[model samples]
Target: MIQIKDLHKSYHMGANSLHVLKGINFDVKEGELVSIMGSSGSGKSTLLNILGMLDEADEGSYTLDNVPIKNLNEKIAANYRNKFLGFIFQSFNLINYKSALDNVALPLYYQGVNRKERVEKAMHYLDKVGLAPWSHHLPNELSGGQKQRVAIARALASDPKVLLADEPTGALDTKTSHEVMELIQGINDDGKTILIVTHEHDIAKMTKRIVNLKDGVIIDDNFVQQVRATQYV
Candidate 1:
């Protein structure tokens, strides 16, 4: 679960001041699948970054599960992110030479998880994403869908509470995108909060709730009574 109130982010471009988020307020409940949709320069990605603590806001407050992210020390925040948050990006962010398993295990390595236990957990997640057979393959060795699956595997390897996916299906074809969404749905079914940022209507429809942002502010918010996913099986 996460909550943001009066959140603001700004950047300086020479003499001009650019505001990315302007006092946005939103709350994501635990085990809910939500989407944030916006067009170019709408600050959806900036909001995601701020929510995930990768970027700081100039004003307002953020709380994850009950702890205030801005109130924590840098080291403590890093530890909390490692322990509770999973991030899926448009770029996949895989290491070029590392095998799928190795890349998925990278976060665990940073947390000092022992090799055997870390690798075992990584492989478990890889299999969950249907990439068990590709565990030894490198990023370049996999196709678009396969690469995304590996990325999802990496995100789940840590058993994170919430998954922040920014344009998660951006790099794949329609079929592959559905496949990835189904996998994410499965994750949500297992009780992980999922916040997806996308511009695609179909992608937004798959979620339980949708929030539209423009000019760094939420313009509309809708919650679907019935949850719809790309796949149930």
Candidate 2:
């Protein structure tokens, strides 16, 4: 479902250039759950940004669902991003004033879904995430796990082909983190291609495959027996 080959990225600050990703190569199949694991400065974030089409690579190729992602105009890139990918961030990224239902509805709003269908789809996903009863609560009114659940619902509301999560369980307590991972695992079970960028070993273990990055390159990529998040939850 996703492919990258010889990917390279760099940032220039004054006379010096910081190389973020070097010769990265990987592929994610349609029903796989994978984690990109790395320490700070190991280029996981750069890789995620490139995969999400939030940033462009300085070199190499990326193809998402067989569509080549290179040199596209901003309009087309944004359109592909919206049509094929969904994102979950550690920060949740919800508007402070928007209620959980409205927050989940925001993506559909951008896609020009009408009010009735937007609310219907939003509520459906919120209920899927077990947050239907709290739909009227704002981000400030919910716990960290609840807020993340809302974010997950928002990410899924559009039914995108790929789900990209950055440090999805970073801010929560262990139990809550496990709970969130369980939810993610459930989503992957239903055949959603999911990629998680996280540094935590336990978190990476929750995924079916772990790709370890170091010094801007993939050092190891291995599929393991998936650990059940419910055991920890």
Candidate 3:
């Protein structure tokens, strides 16, 4: 569902340029659950940003669901982002004052979904994430796990082609992390393509495939026997 070849990115400060991604290449297939692992300065975040279309690569090519992603104007880029990608972040990017239901409906609102259908779709996803009862609660009123679930529901409300999660469980406790991972695993089982950028080993194990990045390049890519997150939860 996603493809990249010879991808490269660099940030310039004054006269020096720090290359973040140097000749990266990988593909993520439909329904595949994959994790990108790396330490600080490993460029996993940069890679994810490029894939998320929040940033662009300085070199190489990216194709998402058969559409080339390069040099598009902001208008078209935003359109593709809405139509083809969903995002979950380390920080649950919810508007604090908005209730969970409203938060989930925000994406649909941007997509021009009418209020009635947005609420219905939002409720459906909130229920899917086990947050239907908490739909009226604000982000601060919910626990970290619940907030993340709300975030996940919001991401899914738009029904994008791919889900990109950046350190999704970073702020949660171990048990809560497992709970979230279990939910994510179930989503993958239902054939939603997911890419998680995580430094946690056990978290990466929960995925069907792992791609290790070091110094802006993929050092290892392999499928593994998936570790069910339920057992840990």
Candidate 4:
């Protein structure tokens, strides 16, 4: 579902350039759950940004669902991001003033989904995330887990080709983190391809495969025995 070969990126500050993602190569098949793990400056975030089409690689090739992702115009990139990728962030990234329902409906709103269908689709996903009863609650009114669930629902509302989560369980307590992972595992079981970027070992173990990055390159990529999040939850 996703492919990357010889990916490279760099950030320039004045005369010096800090190279990131030196020669990354990987592929994610449809319905697979994978985690990208790395320490600080390991380029996991850079890789994620490139995978999400939020940033362009300085070199190499990326193909998402067979569509080349190099040098896309801003308008085309934004459209592809909307149509092909869904994002779940550690911070939840919800608008505090908006109710959970409204927050979930925001993407659909941008997609030009009509009001009636938007409401219907939003409610359906909120319910799917077990947040239907709290749909009217604002982000500030919900717990950390609830807010993240709302974010997940928002990501899922569009049914994108893949879900890219950045430190998805980073901010929550252990139990809550496990609960969120359990939900994520269930989603993957239903055949949604997911790629998560996280620093936590336990969290990475929950995924079917782990790709370890160091100094801008993939050091290891292998499928491990999947650890079900339910055990921890």
Q: What is the TM-score of each candidate against the true structure?
A: 0.94, 0.98, 0.99, 0.99
1-233 per-residue lDDT for model 3 (tens digits): 99999999999999999999999999999999999999999999999999999999999999999999999889999999999999998899999999999999999999999999999999999999999999999999999999999999999999999999999999999999999999999999999999999999999999999999999999999999999988887
lDDT of 4 at 46: 93
Native-to-model Cα distance after best TM-score fit, residue 227 in candidate 1, in Å: 6.7
Name the better of 2 and 3 by TM-score: 3
Q: Rate residue 63 of model 4 by lDDT.
A: 98
Off by over 4 Å in 1: 71-74, 225-233
TM-score preference between candidates 2 and 4, better one: 4
Better of 1 and 2 by lDDT: 2
Write candidate 2's Cα lDDT for 124-222 as tens digits: 999999999999998999999999999999999999999999999999999999999999999999999999999889999999999999999999999
TM-score of 4: 0.99
Candidate 1, residue 207: lDDT: 86
What digit string (tens of lDDT, one per residue) describes model 1 on residues 139-172? 9999988988888888888888899998999988
lDDT of 1 at 2: 90
In model 3, what is the error at residue 202, expressed in angstroms? 0.6
What are the clash counts of all predictions, listed in order?
A: 0, 0, 0, 0
lDDT of 4 at 16: 100
- CA RMSD of all predictions: 1.8, 0.8, 0.6, 0.6
Model 4, residue 170: displacement in angstroms?
A: 0.5
Worst 10 residues of 4 by lDDT: 224-233
